[model samples]
Target: MKGVVISMIVVLAMIQFMVKPGQAISCGQVDASLAPCVPYLTGGGNPAPACCDGVKNIKGMAATTADRRAACNCVKDAANRYSNLKDDAAQALPAKCGVQMNIPISKSTNCDVIN
Candidate 1:
């Protein structure tokens, strides 16, 4: 019985791991702050229309003209460096999204500036 219980526990743990956890969006569902692009940020979620709309409303980011250009190039470079469309497309994500990639949010606005 002891062995059986241990096996069952392990099975349960494996099942939980296999299950899709939840939305990958860190800022919550469709919030303006995250631009409804939470999924895109995780490279697994889909960008909500509201998120796209919010992207347009964001104000100035902390970046210089040169830094913006460099950030843009970095986005492209990251895209090429990563595998799969999700990872590559994430290169264009905003500051919030960039944070998920371990890149600083300050670098976020540059991708748009470069494009």
Candidate 2:
């Protein structure tokens, strides 16, 4: 069971590396870029400079519609990993970081809506 769980984690982690169709960014990039946003997104503290930097980085990575939606899904999945993650704060991070997200950051955001 333990090995199975670890394998599943590895698979999910690798999922971000697979670029399908017109996707411009990978989920791995999204994960790394948003690592600094945990405190603000989880409501543990205000957005730090590093967090804003990460937001800016994500803005650059998600350059295409497929990439934006992929990043959104990645972010949503990451947030869902945290039980206390706040939807409002997650939605507000982009604007707060001086970046505007083409797709909203809510967990309910449909990645397929990019078209």
Q: What does each candidate score in C-alpha RMSD? A: 14.2, 5.2
Which runs of model 2 end up more than 4 angstroms from their true locations? Answer: 1-23
Which number leads on lDDT?
Answer: 2
Clashing residue pairs for model 1:
35-51, 36-51, 39-45
> What RMSD does model 2 have?
5.2
lDDT of 2 by residue, 5-87 (tens): 55755564466456474556776767766766777888745789978887887787778777777788887787778888888
Question: For each predicted model, how many residue pairs clash, with residues at least 3 apart or on different chains?
Answer: 3, 0
Candidate-wise lDDT, in order: 0.40, 0.74
lDDT of 1 by residue, 1-115 (tens): 9788557545644543453433222211112233244456556555666554444322222134543344344434534443443643454555433232323232234355342
